[model samples]
Target: MATIHKLIALALAFTALVVVVSPATYKEGDPIEHKSLTLGEVLDGDRMAHSLYDIKFRTDVPSKKVLCNVKYTEKMLDVLRSAIEDLYYFEFVLDDIPIRGFIGHLEEGGFLPHNHKIYLWAHLHFNIEYNKDHIIYANVTTKDQLPISLDGATTPMELVFTYSVKWMNTDLSYEDRGTRLRDNSFFPKNLEIHWLSIINSLVLVFLLIGFVVIIMTRVLKSDFARYNIEDEEEADDLDSDDNGWKIIRTDVFRFPPNKNLFCAILGVGSQFLALATGILLMAMAGMFNVHRHGAINAAAVVLYAFTSSKLG
Candidate 1:
């Protein structure tokens, strides 16, 4: 059985290595522009597999480059019109990283013939971050693009496509690159961490803990006084007086009717609380290295397995 287990584990490790994605390569300052331009709807959907349109790039230098000039034929104009009407966006791949681009806008509340003015986007911008000799991160944005309106020439117009590249030196480690990107582009404004909100939460947690300790301490003090009084007076007097709480004999300390269920619930709660504390301590001791690609979750799962095995 142990031999079989080892073989299975080896097979799983081999499978993982086989399916692992190779990191996209980028020379010191040079970024590779993929030939295929993936175009799709604003939301995630199927994109084009091949390069539908011919795009030429002149790599003059890493800093600036003339991307391409597209002469639109009747068919190309139809495609552009459909994409604009359907709110489709084209994506440019640099270093195997995709950046979304907004093509143009279609006039609403007008007849098809009246909305003949075609606004075409011409420029593309790329921001690449590198650490000394290695490219750490790259992002391409076509947002807030100023379009050149081809007003009169509606049939087949030639559009000159241009692009600009900017390289920035970054001090961030590789593991923190994903976090920086998410915090910059993806994180919602309203959900951002505010100092005021954090302060409020910390105060609230302390207040709750203090309240529980104070309340429990005061309640048990009276019970301790009652115990001393019972020793002097008859014990029957304490048994008859069931109005208030007592830590030893009252309802607060009594065993629940469904004792098994109560024990199970209490045990599970305690285990989870201990598990959380263990994870917190590990993090404080610098156990959490990578914050991306489920590294933290993987660590948590392994810790949970060991803790659970010991408990069992």
Candidate 2:
């Protein structure tokens, strides 16, 4: 009975380990929480009546189909009337967006009415100003207001949508490059090849190489190989000499064991995984931005220190 209990415990532990290591599918709009602090600001309150808004929310990184709608009473400013149309495109930056997370269809993501309603009350505010020389200043503010409804319970989720509006020829210019880059950057872009496929391919390649080395070593060291094959002249010579013992294949004994090569390959592969994961974590911490000149190196070193704990 004790032995059976031990076996059961071992089996459970092995199963848990397998599941933890396995790669699983994670789509955009999945209920992942944002890890970084978020901030947004509205700039340029007047001149052609421009408005800018920035919002930061704890949300699933790179959410699919981020629906943003601006609601305000229409007033005298003509530019404000056509604010969504005249100004430059809205900029939505995903802070710490997972490198492997991708955007997909809402139905494909399995978001229900309850989840959609959580974002219903969230909105951005646009305050525009027009100056004498046809210069426009826009200050967009974000606000949260729940619609009155007696029937349903309010959603528990807290959401922040960080955004900034820039109106200029340069802002318009970025539309092509920025939109193109953003669209291509997400994970599952090749929707057919999921995370499971990549992980499985790596695991299978490693296992095949390991097994081949193990099998070849075992086969070369076995005694049964001595009787299996020999050139015709060698066999005849053996018989003529009346040698009772069979001659082993010389090819099998010719080479020494290459355990070092096998061990080195395995060890390097494990280290490569650790290094790759650490680099990604540091990148997400915003320590290695090409534009950030101040203390970037220091921040990266500190982040590396924290990640090094895992290796030890």
Candidate 3:
């Protein structure tokens, strides 16, 4: 009874520990806290753009070039139309570019075709120029405009704007991947320390969980041994008799096992083996620095029927 209690307590404690530790190790929140938008979504379109006026000066370098692109949805057509019609420049303060782009409206195909839902698309360009000391800095801002309107808006608008920027230092060498393709010299430096700190915290949590598990397992084992009673021992000894085995054989094996139990055990075991093997192969490939193209899951079953033949 004591051993059973200890085992139950150990299981409960381990479960509780896992629940607490696992959450801390891996937690994902809004990439941009105030403006719940990812880098990709922010670049997608401006109408959908979250109101993030200040590009919190994370990190940047003059020598190391950085490029940024902004895209706006069709809804932005109204804003642009109002800007162009007003003649007064709707000043958009860009921190990095150190300037603003004056927007305007034009006829269909004046910028690009009025596609499925888009009124038009615009592009903005930034080229780096240097001061007298040859210290490179963004020197020019090129404003490209598209004229358009949106269906969802209560009023008519023109020119939806979307822009992409790319910057490269002639001085630096770097590899190009889908993500993190910036020159390390200019890469957001502050984020490096912050992300590393998060990683270290996760590692510490994992180690603490391991230590807790070890200590709890050892303590429970000792406790169980100390409190184990004598009556259950005698019962177990009696249950080990030869007649017990005979009774089990007659009651269970005599029926050749229930079909449901046989199928369940066989099916579950086979599936588990197959799944474990697949996971092992995938893990091995990943460990060896191999990229997994895809995963394959398979299931198979064979059925057979038998007939007896008799000879006279």
| Clash numbers, per candidate | 0, 24, 7
Candidate 1 ranges with C-alpha deviation above 4 Å: 1-125, 143-183, 204-212, 230-240, 243-264, 267-291, 310-312
Q: Give the Å shift of residue 228 in candidate 3.
A: 31
Residue 301 error for model 2, in Å? Answer: 5.0
Reference-based TM-score of each model:
0.45, 0.22, 0.25
Best by lDDT: 1
Pick out the ten consecutive residues of candidate 1 with the lowest summed lDDT: 1-10
Candidate 1 colliding pairs: none
What lDDT score belongs to each candidate, Candidate 1 first?
0.49, 0.32, 0.33
- Our model 1 lands, by Cα RMSD against the true structure, at 12.5
Worst 10 residues of 3 by lDDT: 1-10
Candidate 2, lDDT over the whole model: 0.32
* Candidate 1 lDDT tens digits, 1-312: 011000000011122111110001111233332323222121222222222122222211243344444455565566555556665555434333344545665555567556455565666566667665544666556554677764455555656555665667789986566566555552247765588988999999999999999998997786766766736556555655654554345666778799988777777676677778888898678665422223456555666677675442
**Regions more than 4 Å wrong, model 3:** 1-152, 155-159, 167-246, 256-261, 287-312
TM-score of 2: 0.22
Q: Rank the candidates by TM-score, best first.
A: 1, 3, 2
